[model samples]
Target: MKKYLVVLVSMLGSLSMMGQTNTWVNDPAHSRLGFVVKHLTISEISGRFADFSVKVTTSKPDYLDAQIEVTAKIASMDTGVEMRDNHLRSADFFDAEKYPTLTFKSTSVEKTGKDKGKLHGNLTFHGITKPVVVDVVYFGTVTNPMNNATTAGFQIKGVVKRSDFDLGPKFPEAVISNDVQIIADVEFSPNK
Candidate 1:
């Protein structure tokens, strides 16, 4: 009967909607993308990108099946020192004028534990793309009292070699360590 067919179609549509993926956008006010590297083989220097955007897509509430993408402006690097920051953005290092942005797109996600996972992705920097893996810790989700919006938190940590991307090739290892530690703490809310 026509009535029965319409009801069945509506039921199926609702079920499909329940399984649809949701997109989450990073909250800039609650997120940070930073890095640390050894300076002069004794001290460490830390810096963060001032402009970036992250997007996450998932069909699960736990983020077990999440796909993440990020774009960060290379010229936005801030190390609290204007001279050093400008030098870093020059051709001697990032060459920010040529490669204006760094980007990452997840290839796969492997769950290591209930709240831990390994995120494998392609990181593109300085016009080079390399596969990288980062450890992810899900801090779970909470409802914000101010806006009544559900927000999810995650911390991602990884180590990258500057040599791999041919970054700062002019600087010796003793002057600037080849190893750079990347750390990002991000909060995401469903895209409106």
Candidate 2:
């Protein structure tokens, strides 16, 4: 009976570990990684990375202790103008050839309300990493009719200084604003 009790305890431990977290894949079709920056200290230039991936791990329905990671391809930036987009990918800016991807990993999630929270994370870009805090809004969840998978939506907004990442020096602050505004609309579906 002692041996059987030990076996049962091991099984229960395994089950608890397996159920500790749920994995969710970002749905690219319904997600966007976008940013806006001021140009010539006047008009604003907006762009987005066409390719990005995100994974959300959570143990609770409220997402109070959730963790998130994201990767974005620098070569996929689109600013509508071909020349400007190419310039952004060159050594003058992001240098997509050397640093192919920008990444973010969350450290903490603080829930403020039923659908609002503050997400603190480390954002890595242009070979530098810095802590950033962003406002997050949860849009609840739904079951997809096509695949019968549970999906959740979220919107995140934050601002980061380009100079903090050592990304740009070719243009002065007057020519190009140092601040970059980030906005992301993300949809995640549970992994099968």
Q: Best by TM-score, which number?
A: 1
Worst 10 contiguous positions by lDDT, candidate 2: 14-23
Candidate with top lDDT is 1
Per-residue alpha-carbon lDDT of model 1 for 92-170, expressed as tens digits?
9999999999999999999999999999999999989999999999998999898999999999999999999999998
Give the alpha-carbon lDDT of every model. Answer: 0.95, 0.92
Q: How does each model score on TM-score?
A: 0.91, 0.88
Q: Per-residue CA lDDT of candidate 2, range 92-171, in tens?
A: 98999999999999999998887999999999978889999999999989997887888899999999999998877878
In lDDT terms, how accurate is model 2?
A: 0.92
Can you give the lDDT of residue 170 in candidate 2?
72
Ten residues in sequence with the least summed lDDT for candidate 1: 59-68
Give the local distance difference test score of model 1: 0.95
Quote the lDDT for 165 in model 2. 88
